[model samples]
Target: MTPKKEQMTMKQMMSRRAVVRVPSGPASIETIDVPVVEPGPGELRVKIGAAAINPVDLGVAGGLFHQLALVDQPDYTGLGWDFAGTVEATGPGVELPGGTRVAGFIDGFDRDHGSHAEHLLVPAANVAVVPDGLDLVEAATVPLNATAAAQLVDLLGAPPNDARRLLVTGAAGAVGAYVAALAKDRSWQVTGMARAADEQFVRGLGVDFTTDLGQAWDAVADAGALQEDAFRAVREGGRFIGMQPAARLPEERGIAVEVVFARPDGALLARLLARVATGELPARVHAVAPLDEVACAYQAMAQGSIRGRIVLVP
Candidate 1:
């Protein structure tokens, strides 16, 4: 069913708990009611236990994406994306039944129903079972970040076989760190760009070089003028995957620069979830808070001061 449905066939559903943003000039999270959803075809309604607050959550809370939202009144939006929860119900034509613990990606629903809730209804295309022996809180963190990293290396054109040199921006953060680690596993040489204080941390993530944009990716003459040295490091045809827009152009050097805006994908999430279960990857849970603290969680993201995932507990 579409997000507008008020009630469903299941009458026993609780009006789920959620944190909604009320727009004045600033943003804050407040308690709101949500309907218990029955999954339609290719749908899954998760009884959310752990949901992570990410940058998008903060942006939605602050109304940073009002222009991008398909629905207006995004100020009244629900504000979380990453989650680890259990299957409360499955829609028609599904493989698994209820009670499967899953972690997957979520794009906020019409700027309204996000993962910062007691229960969440997510598309079947964005789900997978949580890896065996994985902590639910930790499992919530992997999906969005994985999608961002994977989009650059997997969805976009990155030569899989070559030992290419690549640049990762925001390398000390969750997504970047995971990207660097994953690159190492895939035999790519990784150079991580971060503030000096985060150098060692980035290096620990299996990155070969940790530098500020000046040394790592090369600041490129204050980001306005291009530097030959910077171009040389990436080599011709090397990739630059980043969350931020490049302040300068890379085409001058024939380098491929990709801006990866993350998306939710259940199939991808299933693979990542499988990797975590197989001990090929690790997921980290930074903090866990109840749904009421979603505002604080979003605030942490907006401030750029978080180290790992922030979960909203039911």
Candidate 2:
């Protein structure tokens, strides 16, 4: 005998969305009627609760990934990489029910859909269960920043001779702060670069010390400019990980300089979320705004020097 099919609830679907084009104009939130996106195989349709605004989002809106995307999708793209939401529908081969809370990111260059909307569709492998006692709002901020930090540390590899001294430029920023904390947890002696005002906060994250680029360069003659300054405190042969992608750092005096660009990884994100719930790592949030205020969120990020992430609640 054939089995009965499960009933799926359908609601009036209108998604206020943010769209970016190849010309790369600024992104603004606009309310418009949107078709309900049925999940394909290995996909889930989530009702987005919150999404975080990252600097890369702005980069995408400015057409940074346009060339990469055109090879796959030949049209205007959507933005928003990080989001937390409830599963509203499951596609073929998906096991999660219609109410499971989860968080994840869409590859900004994927060009399918993004998180800045009432509903989002993403791969099942790209999401992790939100841990108990963590707000979806805060969980929304983790996937991108934490993943970036993890990737940077991973690139640095295991410390040599069981003696680890690491330097993190932009340590007070979102990605850098997490890097410092995570490296500290791994028994690396961390020296963070941040302005004097943030010394207390940077040290609170378990960093052994904090200094600015000026202070780091004063002793090193700014070899290779600000990035190489990070090498001043790092033990010779130690690693210098930089958060700024555009900045160039020269390898000098046996110190290695590397730049990290965070990519989406659901499995690693799941582990990081578990750490947050257990108080092993902290998720810092600067502010929360409704999705309608997405422009303001972007503007705030552009102004610079916000300690944590700005989350947009849908």
TM-score of each: 0.79, 0.81
Q: Write the per-residue lDDT of candidate 1 for residues 54-163, one digit (tens) a residue.
A: 66566555655664554475346666678888898888877777888988876644656777777777777778888778878878888887776766566334345553
- What is the number of residue pairs that collide in model 1? 3
Clashing pairs in 1: 125-266, 126-266, 127-266
Cα RMSD for predicted model 1: 5.9
CA lDDT for candidate 1: 0.65
lDDT of each: 0.65, 0.72
Question: lDDT at 261 for candidate 2?
Answer: 62
On TM-score, the candidate that comes out on top is 2
Q: Which stretches of candidate 1 lie over 4 Å from their true place?
A: 1-12, 17-27, 67-71, 155-163, 214-239, 244-253
